[model samples]
Target: MSTHDTRNTRGRGATHMENGSITQHENHTRMREMTQRNQDMERMKEEVIRHVQSRLNEVLERALTDSLQSLSTHTQTHTDKTESTNNRHKLEEGKVFIARCSLLDELFEISHIRTIYHMFIAALFLFIMSTLAVDYIDQGRLVLDFDLFYYAFGQLGTVVWAWTLMLSYTLLGPYHVLRVWGEQALRSRWRTCVCALTLCAAQTSMLGIFPVCVVLHYQLPPASRFIIILEQIRLVMKSYSFIRETVPAVLKNTTQKDKSQRYPSLSSYLYFLFCPTLIYREVYPRNPSIRWKYVGMNFLRILASLFYLYFILVRLCIPVFRNNSHQLFSSRSLILMLFHAAFPGMLILMLGFYAFLHCWLNAFAEMLRFADRMFYKDWWNSTSFANYYRTWNIVVHDWLYYYGYRDFLLLSGYKLRSMATLCVFAVSAFVHEYAFTMGFGFFYPVMFCTFAGIGVVFNFAMNDSRKSPVWNIIMWVCLFIGQGIHVCLYCLEWYAQIHCPRTGTSFWELVTPRSWTCNYQ
Candidate 1:
């Protein structure tokens, strides 16, 4: 029984062992497959990393190349341009844009500005029609009387004579005296000073004393006297400019003159007297041809402006002033008169600026073939009183700056800019006041106060830095008010003279303003 049982147990154990061995083999095969799959995944990850890195490197290289190329192109362009500019400058080529025509000339080439010219013509026609209608309505018929103008401008021959006298002094005397002084000054410096002083005294007599005599002794009418006196002032200013400009050169070249140097030619002197410029250059750029058509047009503009002024005075000034003359004088009355005069005053200002500075100066310049025609800048567009003062009359400004201010600086050893400026202001104011006094035959200080007090205040207050349009409007308002004051006061005095004739020509009576005491009512 024991032998059978043992044999069965041994057989079962051997079968069980065989089954366990099969299970172990299957487990080993599955583990080996999983390890193989993990190794393959690792190899794929390495390949992906290498490929992405290579692509990034290519992008960086391309971006750097493009950036370099752009930088190179820009650098090369700038360098080429700079080199060309340098070469041109170094060569000092011909015709380097020395002179161009005025900015106004360019604008005139445009249609809009030309249209403005037509507008002016239209305005002139309107003025004519208005004057005719007004006169026809007022007097029940149109007389077309020009007698007032004729009477105002009566005796212009004395003006011509006074002008001739002033011109003779300027043309003939100054140069010779300068030459003699220059020759003598070569030996001694004090001699130069003495001779200069002596010349100054002689010039004062010729320019100042003689013209005053002509004005007083001849008893010139207001308009005729204005012509002479203004001419006198012009001559004095021009002569001073000439002497200041030329005397230094003469003195400097004295030794050079002894040793084959040249003196200023007579032709140059004559040209300087006639030329529009106050700062004289011996040889100025000239036009190729005289534009006679332009000259004729300018002259026509002058005549039109004169008629325009006449119409304004007759229609606006006479009506306003004549009606008001009978009113009792008071601050209220004067203020009302000023307000009424504003339009006519503005018209007069415009006519004065356009006629004298633009038309008259341009005509003379064209006829003389003077190339530099920058008589006035855009003064109407000025934003400040200082700017207006500077651009209002460039000719006069140049003279005063070169002669009065600059010369004063020199005489004062070049230290006082403010003092020099003040001196220039004083001279200008004095001359203006003198002209007014002589013309109106009264010593009213309106112009003097306006010029010295208000002008100075505005010059400092509304200075060059004021660039706003508001400031420009303010400047214009000030100009209108100032012009209004001038027209009202001067016209009052004019009527006052006719209404209140003085019994005696004593100093007090002649010098005092008749407008203050007149009872036209």
Candidate 2:
């Protein structure tokens, strides 16, 4: 019995030992699986961290680049504002003035702008050589005769007399009348009205009736006519400027104490006449000294530009138009002529811009020490017609903006915005058409249609939101086509006028374009 009991105890102990070994093995496997999972979780966390860090670096880099560009642009703009402020802050002993800015002091710091000037100079040289080459090939040798220019500008005596008369009236009559009546404290509405009427009548006679009479009666050539008409507009604009500025102040200070204060000094008025500005001020910012070399260079460029225009017109226009008045008018021929004229048209456009905006204005500005040189902006790089027109001729634009468009807006109490825009376009078109008609001695509605009609269409179509390069290309293409059409059509009309002389002295016959009936005749 003792031996059987002992065996049972041994069996139970073996079973318990087996159970213990199995439990040990299960715990070790569980530990191994948990260790592997922990390692995988750590690896995933490390990868996520790396990815986030890289993204952060990229965003920071882009932000830094953008910040730098903005800073540079702002700095440049600030520099411009600073120079402009410097220009108008002259404290003459007794003279008061408005604060303003100049463009030259800001733009010249950029090296690329100088490069652009050099490029234009190079282009001038190229233009000269190109003209010489064509002349040499056609005429067996170069025959440089500037007789066309000489003849067109031959009778300057008449223009000088007209200018002298206009200048004397502007310098003497209006300035004195404004001061005399303004100082009297008359408070007479009828007197003011009479003075205003007199001034208006005088201005009209000088700018309107007198010029039309001279052009029609004397029958001046195109170039000489341009001188008289442009001067007429210039004088009118200057006179209006003087009145616009001084009259307000005079009326504002209607009190007895303010009456004794002087109108703008005579020297200021004279300076305003010669200065390259259409806006009038009591005192203008002046340079300390004149740069004679700069003046001479601009004048030289003006002469070169004249020759350039001569070359372009002679070589590119005369040959094509000399025989066009005799040819049959067809869509195909018209299209061909337009395409051919495009080259010279562009040249003419560029030359005119350079000659007037840069050379002529800058020369006068330099001589007058007119430091506010914001005459034009960078218009060539414009992507929209709206921007282009604003930048093209800032002086004229300012006049129109301040006097015409703004006044109309004010008069209408800011309503009729579209109508105001249309009015601006109409006035501009009228002036342009008038100038062209008087200069060329014909009424070819080509200038009017392109400006008032097509120009308005484009102004609305290619608006300011179009900032892409594609839009810029389209704008340039349209300019090229428009200019080509203008040149081709004008050349055709000019030739027809010469070839088809008027048989009857009727007003309609004189005003009518000869090109239309010349082909049919």
Candidate 3:
């Protein structure tokens, strides 16, 4: 039992020992793998954290750069604006200082420049005086003979004389005179001058051919039509009635110079309506530069005469005879034509005449007479466009400024200064129409009112300086064309209303076919 049992037990014991050793080795291998995996996971987590911190740093740097760049750009823009504003201020100050310096040095600086200036001024004075004196002599009917041909020839001679004097004074007279007298600023000033020249040139050319064209185109009549004479008389009577009614209304509103002052004449009323009140009140601060400007204006007087002569011959006398007519040199026909062109033309002509006379007298007084009273009380004393508007024909401007401009603004309850300007201009057009009705005995107020109303609206609506140049030119052209159309329409209406019996025969009806035309007699 001992030998057999011992042998079997030893074998079983060996087997059991081997099985236990194998199990122990397998367990050790599993523990090693699990520990290694955990260590690798911890290393991976650390690497991921480091990578995230690096990315955040990069983003932070980018954000800082963008914020700094934006701030710098803003700072630069502000600095530039400040610098530009400073420069503008400096320029304005410099101009004012220089002007003051010039005035201070005037007495000491009176050298050859001064002498030449004075001499040229004297020559201009003489030229203007001579032209005006000649005009007066002609107008006063001093010449004994009054034949039509002679009258025409004399007028032509007067025009030639005026032209000659103007050219001679401008070319041969002092050099300073040209500089002082002829220099003009503002785009509108030049445009107006060009338009005036165009008018004269065109009209003169047309007029020169009129007599020949008339004679060739139609047979002469023994007697002029009496119907036109009666029409004109009726028109005048109607116009007189309108004016009589209007004048009293105007008088009631106008403040008098004194309680004793009588009611104004038609001419005076015209002056009031057209002229600016601001001219009577000082607009600009007084300075030597301003004073010298008047002297220069005096020199320009001769040139103004040339303009006047051009208007009288080309605008008035010539246009009337452009087409062929049955009546040859008939006084009644001439009068009729004159009446047709009278209102607007007279308003324009009177303003020019007043300016011309003032300048002429101012020049003469400054050069030959050296009268202070003339400078103070004379017409050219208000030669500035603003002054001329206000003082010389103050009633017109006053009416515009007060009733037209101020009243409109107040009535409309507009607080903006810009709108106020529009209100005034619109009012001006209205009053101008009213005046026109008094002269024409028709409701031309609508046409003229619209024309002027547009101008007022435009002057206000398009107030930006950048847009002004083109707009101003357009306005001027429109005004010229509108007025021309108005004149033509009036003429056509007068003809149709008198001759045509049809309900749609009135000019307004012909154009728009209104019910009013059907009811008119």
Candidate lDDT values, in order = 0.80, 0.80, 0.42
Task: Give the per-residue lDDT digits (tens) of candidate 1, residues 1-521.
Answer: 59999999999999999999999998899899999999988867766776698799999999988986787687988867776676545433211112445546655756678899789779878878887797889888866787768977988887877688788878888877877776566688788788778888888898889877887888877788888778777777666767766766775677455566566776898898888777666788888899999999989989888888888888789877877777666799999999988878998998898898888888898898888777778897899988898898888887776667666766776557788777888888988999988776667888999988888888888989999999989988888899999999998887887888888978898777777788867
Candidate 2 minimal-lDDT segment of 10 residues: 90-99
Candidate 1 structure, TM-score to reference? 0.77
Q: Give the per-residue lDDT of model 3 (tens digit) for 1-521.
A: 69999999999999999999999999999899989988988867766776698799989998988886777687988867776676445422311111122221232244555675466456446545555666578686333222322433333333344334433332222222212222321124665456445534533333223322332233222111111222222222222232333334334534342345333334433222222111211121223323556567656655654444444434344445333132343456545654555544443444354454355444443343222222112223321222333444432343345434454544655345566665555555654564444333344455555546555554444444323346545544444455444544454344333444345446764444121232222
- For candidate 2, write residues 380-448 as lDDT tens digits: 778899888888888898888777776776688655768877888888898899888888888888888
Tell me each candidate's RMSD, in Å, in order: 27.2, 21.2, 34.5
On the 0 to 100 scale, the lDDT of residue 143 in model 3 is: 33
TM-score to native of every candidate shown? 0.77, 0.77, 0.30
